[model samples]
Target chain A: MPSDVSAPVSNGKPGRLRRLIAARAEGEALRKGNLLVLAVLLLVAVVALLPFYWMLSSSLRMPDQMFANPVQWIPNPINWASYPEAWGAQNFGRYFFNSSVVAVLITLGNLLFCSLAAYSLTKFRFRGRHLSFMLILSTMMLPLEITMVPLFLIVNSFGWTNSYQGLVVPFLVEGFGVFLMRQYMLSIPTDVIEAARIDGASELRIFWMIVMPLCKPALVALAIFTFREAWDLYIWPLVIITDDALRTLPLGISLFMSGYGTAWDQVMAIAVLGTLPMALLFFFLQRAFIQGIAGTGLK
Target chain B: MSPVSSSRSARPGPASSGPKTPGRRPWLTPGSKQTAFAWAILLPALLILAIFRFLPMLEAFYLSFTDYDLISPPRWVGLQNFIDLTQDPLFLKSVQVSLIYVSCSVIPVIPLSLGLAILFNRALLARNFLRSAIFMPVVMPAVVMAVVWTFMYQQDGVMNTILGWVGIDPVPWLRSSSTALWSVIMIGIWRAVPYYMVIFLAGLQAIPRDYYDAAKIDGAGSWATFRYITLPLLKPTMLLVVVMNVIVAMKVFAVPMIMTGGGPGDATRVLPLFIYQTAFEFFDMGKASAMSVVMFAILMAFAFIQVRLFTRKEEQ
Candidate 1:
């Protein structure tokens, strides 16, 4: 087929004319295919974003006019009061504070500790090295349901229930973070570490100075992922946090829905606020966010 | 709960070339110093994992067999909790419900996502814009998704209104037990498709373009190219998507918990929700642990298959 097309049908003018027409037809088909792909993707994107768009639009939907019959696609008279009303309706301010503090602390802990552990694993050779690596790897697959009981008991033993320690400590350094940092750290050459060591830099110093900086991209990815995971904490917090004041954003939103009963506008407003931090993180670290999943070759 | 980070199996590598100066620093570090260094750096992570992670993971197995109610010392009752679960209709029903939910949501996702990926793989106009728009839900916390969907699925809400446009009746999305599980499952698919699409898109992008060029020159149609070149190459990625999605789907708790609280009846009460209620609401820790162990066994079987698949591929 290729020979026939490229040989230019060297015999005649009719053949050359046919080839030009065929090429033009192919271009038209290519254009047609492009349009089809574009149309399908666009349609799917609209459907995918519809709920988010609804959350935003409905949040802005006028509180009194929220019940208008035909489904207000756009809030005809835009309302910003729901944002303030929703914020005041519950302990959302407190929820926001708790979520931020916990997410930040967890992210910082993961960035520091996971890197240390990964660096140790990648740069050093020791007895039972493979065992420890596999052990950490195994924990990554253990769902919270499997371990929640004993973990709850352990947290309760320390009198940490309803406290920040219970929410913050168990998730401080996750297995995903450890594995991510380790994979990236493996590509960091050992020569840099050896030189730093020969110069009498402490192991901690080398990790802090040489290893940490080299692992910057991975650290950013880990930080974004850790913060996202921490922000998404619901079941664990719901189980442990009995006090309403200690509720995170997820709990607060659920509580607000139940407490306010039918305040649809306010409920949507809180949903928007609940999702804001993650949206902001996506805006800034979209590359790291996508790369963390794609580069790691898992979803 | 499935770890998606760098799920590639750890494999041995070729020996590294020796240092240019062989006498310099003993090629990385000496043996004894390396062990001390490893211990020093590894202690904090190891200690934390040992206390909170490893212990709890192992204890999950033991806790399943004992009768504990959070009030007193757990008494040994080997296989009693598991046996009771077999007798409990709700637990048995939940297992059935979960299997149906996983199959319904996960099976449809592969083709839907792969289709999306194939479209986005082309250099169509506004490709990134379209890709990001679809992917936005994956970033939204599951809590927000549940709430938003709960609102949308109201009797007189946007969903029903849309259905009315097409002359369809307002189905009780969350009000009826029959549609309640499917309502949550729809949301599950909504959130899941984009995530798996991203995975599939990455897989598509990694394939060499030369394969397509060769197929095109051979007069192979688009479907033939996809069937031969794309599908075969996407096997590993497809396995990851299927296994991870199954594991994640089996653990679907937040959506069902928030949306229906297990249902108008026992319709949406999945395994995790059942476990939560048994442990916390009913204060039957032993029963909940037993259920989790059962869920764990199911997930482990999927995981084992994944390992076998990958190892087989590597051998090939």
Candidate 2:
């Protein structure tokens, strides 16, 4: 009736009205389809985050209630005692310090050394330049897992075991970092470097002042990547650090878990503490982090 | 490849800019100076790599052939370690375990990650927040992931509790030999799916929007559009994800090491974890190095494919 009231009596009126109904149906279907997609994505996101939520909830629950029937999704009288107990139980303060020192040094070293190598590889023409680049790229196959035996022998020979140098030195400059920096620097215009060169600016001056400033995004990406890898280092430190005082966070947590397997609250607490720094870093630098990964893959 | 190589060759000659009197300052040629500066900048990194990466690689190869136990000097026994490995049941079992882990984990990762990527690629509300939430697993430290997962996989843990709500009997996740490796495999998929999803999302975004519009005009359905348009354009990204997923899966260590410690039997003893135990716990460096050489070969095959893929892309 409404259609009859609104419709004009013309030859094309029925056909136009039919098209209008079809388009409306299609639009409604599309809207429903979008809602379905959103729901699916939200479910996946929840599934992905469930472990983290469990970690937090377990950390806050009392020891007796950890295995309660129906599963305490939320702790009623929240136990905040686990944090200090876990931290003090294994001298975690020292472990955090060790992790911080090692991660910072490794990050700085990669940013400086990888950028320098990348700059030379990209912007400069010299003999054996391609050879060097190829050789560096080939190192991708030689992950620490395959090389740890000889590396341990080499480190022990240097008497570097149980020292920061053992953990930090071997990982200072990664092949992946060099590759990432090279890929990013390839997009930097050659004229800019040449113009600075023509002005009689020293190479170091040009690198420090002109080139490095233009590479902020790549640098940030490299820094975060190196820092995360260094912070999460487990195998190398497990092999090298026998001294409890020198153990990094991963080593300390593993040892703590083994020693106090029954203390679920404390174990979860250490897990949360160990994960906090990286979570915070990612939270703040989410855009750069995602873009960095996407850039590497797309490139 | 041709463009990059040609650009390298076309760099301006330093001879074009020199003092009028060439013989007076032969050592000060701009070309030589540039070379020197480049080498100076590259020296520190090259030195570090030479010491840490190159030397150890060579040492690993050499040590595989020689019997060494930190106390005694290495004694060369040609092919003996390799021969022993052939007869070693644990080593063989570990290889099987690693193969199973790699195939099972890597296979699911490809489709699941791509599916997630495709879903996220759609325009929707709170997309960014949802993406960030899914990405949280990636930023969790591997050690913490191992610890938290070990907690969750316990008999009375949350994982079993949730299954009960769905009217399913609780399963022994990491306890029995039958399910231990599978449990570790599940964790591997959980962590890796999010990472490779990001990579796949990048690949999806790289696809030109015009293709979809054209497909729609041709009356193509959703499945057909994905099959013809999306699949063909996503070939390179698919290769990258497969290679990277296999590599990560092969190198999985921290989880099994912390969770099962190679298990109640040899259920979850992946190659790397077995190699560690052989070298450190068992003090058989020669055999361990031989195992490393084997891993190196497997990884190199994948790495070779990756390099070819990259070079081919460059040529295009």
Candidate 3:
């Protein structure tokens, strides 16, 4: 018989049989425990996704059946009219265009400007380098909520109110993006940069050709982060945009809800449409998204 | 420039690229060129921030001390807006409501998110699928969440129907002053818990696996392993989550703005919402700036601690 360190050994057939049974029981218990954990986690995940399911299902339900008694978990004869009606009711096309422009510009601007600044902060030794980095870091404390008033006055002074620049310029470069990029850049080997310098590569050429490509993971993460934040911009647009034509998707959806409050089906439809772009973005870049969020906390 | 040249000279290599020009100033070395290049690249970001963030921040402080409405020029009224805010009932109510929101939403999130993180950290069937499922809420935009939750919170709506399954009465969620803040609080927790859970999972994964294995060899139970091996190492992440979550909760604007509009007698009137109304709706820019300064101070207090913790970790 094979010797077991933890289990008592006895020189007999009965002892070997008993050991086999005990090991089998332990294995059975472990499998059952795993099943229990899986079951519990599945339940939590269901609850987490329940709202999304409700949003989609409610969007497909007929107007009258939305508040049906006992709650129809699934819509019967799924109504597709809400989408078209909702889209027709508002200038949703304009709103989607506005959101896309603002978010894309903001994302691209962050990727470019933040990477340039991060490269400077990480790769170069200069006077006030630390001070400049700290200055940028301190801005994280001054979110749009606190600075929006003066920011509004400043935008108004520039004659930017009711303009796209009003929405996009203030948020073109974020403190968090710089900080995220800086943290990621710190991990890069200075030896490689030094070697590039020895090869007589210009500073800008090194940043553009060598450094930027190596930082793809962080850049991808920052891109998605900035895009989502820009797309989700509500308060800034609400404050600056008085022109209905320039309103973003969130602003448009809010107006739609208040103006047509009782049209729950249509409201859900707008909600779904508004959420779809972000959901798709997240789905495609799930790994980068998770890594980006995890990076912030870990760092 | 002298400091830049000296710092560069302190380094052993990379000073060999450019020729040493005769009779040149000490500061006009290769290092100076590098410094100039760095500043050139950094100029755009610094300029943008100067215009948008730093300038406005300074302006907010200045405007808080003046009486400014959009039409007339800002009239210097030292301490008037601050004094008025101290005695304003609605402002006080907003402060109270915001405190309630921040505290209620932040406190429970720590454990709930940490617990969820621990669960998701375990090896299980389709674990990635489950984590992704739970993470779906974070993808939903805040505006959509507010609108959908408003639909679900109606008296005869899905929330009430779910409560019925548990033998509870249909509660008026957003209509009543008493329950309105709590309703907002529920949504805050729902959205936050998943986001922070991901953070906590990251923290969990960071802990060296050898510690847990050592604990198991010592016959330690799961609870003991978690208490000793998990919690201590996760201190930094816990601090990060707390500070981030509190800042986020304090800035809870879109959800309440869209759902209740700080309604049912200012029950859900968070600070940002009140600041918005005070500035734009009432055109009381000075008073709103004062409120914003107060909010900034509160957020800075939390941020100060975070900076301290992170800097200390870096030093170690």
Candidate 4:
């Protein structure tokens, strides 16, 4: 026993028996912990997707089967016709086009204006730069509620009501966009700008050629954000756009509810359809979305 | 910012004084012309924000003083809107509803988010997928959430279906005046938690692992380690999260707007929705604007205190 104890002591380590058990226990615990997290994540994923899943599943179920005594997770005979029915019933095609136009235009405008402004604020030395930046930042803290009255009056005064210009022009630019761009631009090295200038590149050329290409990550992230925001927009669009033809997706959903009544099957159909563009966008550009969010946490 | 002020006022023509060195010349670029160009790029954004965001804010202040109808010219009625708002019963109810909504929704989101962040941080596998799934709702449009949730809360919906498995009878969700606020509160939490969770996750990632190792050597259990290590380190992140959450919660419009539309006997009706209704539905811009001013003051006060508290925490 003395010889064995001395043998293990020479290694400056735990006994083989003790080491083995500790290693086994740690492995077991790690496995268990990972399994538990995965399970919880699976549950969360299910919950996150459930509404969308149910919306699709319900949309496909025969109207009679929807209210069946036992809740139906799977519709045995999927009603493919419901899609067309919903489309026709709500004039979804027109609404989809309207939403597409508005969302796309907003995205384009934001990308161009926001990037340019961000470039200037970040790259160039200007007068009242701090004050200007602060003024822009301060605008973000002011509640949109306070601005509603004057915005309405302004839009009304401009006869923008019920028109595309009314829906589009007021939101063509954003303070948040400027603020975000500025932060991102500040991170780019001053050497790059100087290098471009040394090569006889104009400011516009430098921005378009060097800076814009390098800032792809931020721009892509901002684009995804802008697209999502524009797609889901409701309140302002509802306030300004009164024409049924001009109504965006969210507005269309509300109109469907109030005008035709809360037919769950139909509403879910519209709801599911409305979520598709954003859901698809999310799936495609999820990487950029996460990066954008994580970056936001820093500020 | 410092460079901008000094550079602009001191210059008459920037071409000659544009710095002898080629490196500095590009920066000076004729009459702070580069700055002018920068401002030019920023023009559309400024113009829009000025007219829509800032101008309206000023107009809101102005409207608070008048009895302006949507159709007719305004008649000045100083303090009347504020005075009437004080006595108004619906406005009072709206205020109560808003306070309850903010308190219930904003309070749980912070710790719950932190708890979730820790959970995600400790979990080894499927971290990315889990994080993404949880945050999916945050990016989803609020109106769609309202529509989907409206379905879930229906008598025969999935929520009821799940509840029935435990033998609970169907509960009135958005329909019940008594339960409507709570129902909206739940929706608010569901829609919002992911945002805070993402923020907290970032915060959690920033905390170095060595501290945990040191605590473990001291024979601290998991909870003890968390208490001694994680919570204190998380204070800065927590303060920022809470301040942001409170400010955003105070101005919440979309959730309540689409979910309850401030309905079921005005139970879920909050200040923003009240102002919206007064302006759009009732065509009383004056009253709407007045309500907006009152809400802004309340929000500003809350924000001021939140900032002071955060700075105080930092100093300590």
Candidate 3: tens digits of C-alpha lDDT, residues B130-157: 8888888889999999999999999889
Compute fnat per model: 0.52, 0.63, 0.62, 0.55
Over the stretch B1-316, how does candidate 1's per-residue lDDT look in tens digits? 1132112112233212112222222124547867887878788887888888888867777888899988898999999998898999999999999988988999898889888888776545676677778888888999999999998998888898889999999899999998999998888999889888877876776666678879999999989999889988888778878877887798888889888899889999998888888889998888888888888888888789777977787676
Candidate 3 local accuracy as lDDT? 0.84
Choose the strongest candidate by DockQ.
3
Q: Candidate 4 local accuracy as lDDT?
A: 0.74
What are the per-residue Cα lDDT tens digits for candidate 4 across B4-54? Answer: 635554567422222332233334343566766777877777777788788
* Ten-residue stretch with the least lDDT total in model 4 chain A: A1-10
The Cα local distance difference test for each model comes to 0.79, 0.83, 0.84, 0.74
- Overlapping backbone residue pairs in candidate 1 total 0
The DockQ values of the predictions, listed in order, are: 0.32, 0.32, 0.33, 0.30
**How does each model score on TM-score?**
0.89, 0.90, 0.90, 0.87
lDDT of 4 by residue, A42-66 (tens): 8867777677778788887777877
lDDT of 1 by residue, A215-252 (tens): 77677767876787789888899889998878899898
Poorly placed runs, candidate 1 (over 4 Å) = A1-26, B1-27, B217-220, B308-316
Model 2 DockQ class? acceptable
Interface RMSD of each: 7.4, 10.7, 9.4, 9.5
Model 1 chain A poorest ten-residue lDDT run: A1-10
The digit string of per-residue lDDT tens for model 3 on A50-98 reads: 8898989999998898889868888998999999999999899999999
lDDT of 4 at B153: 84
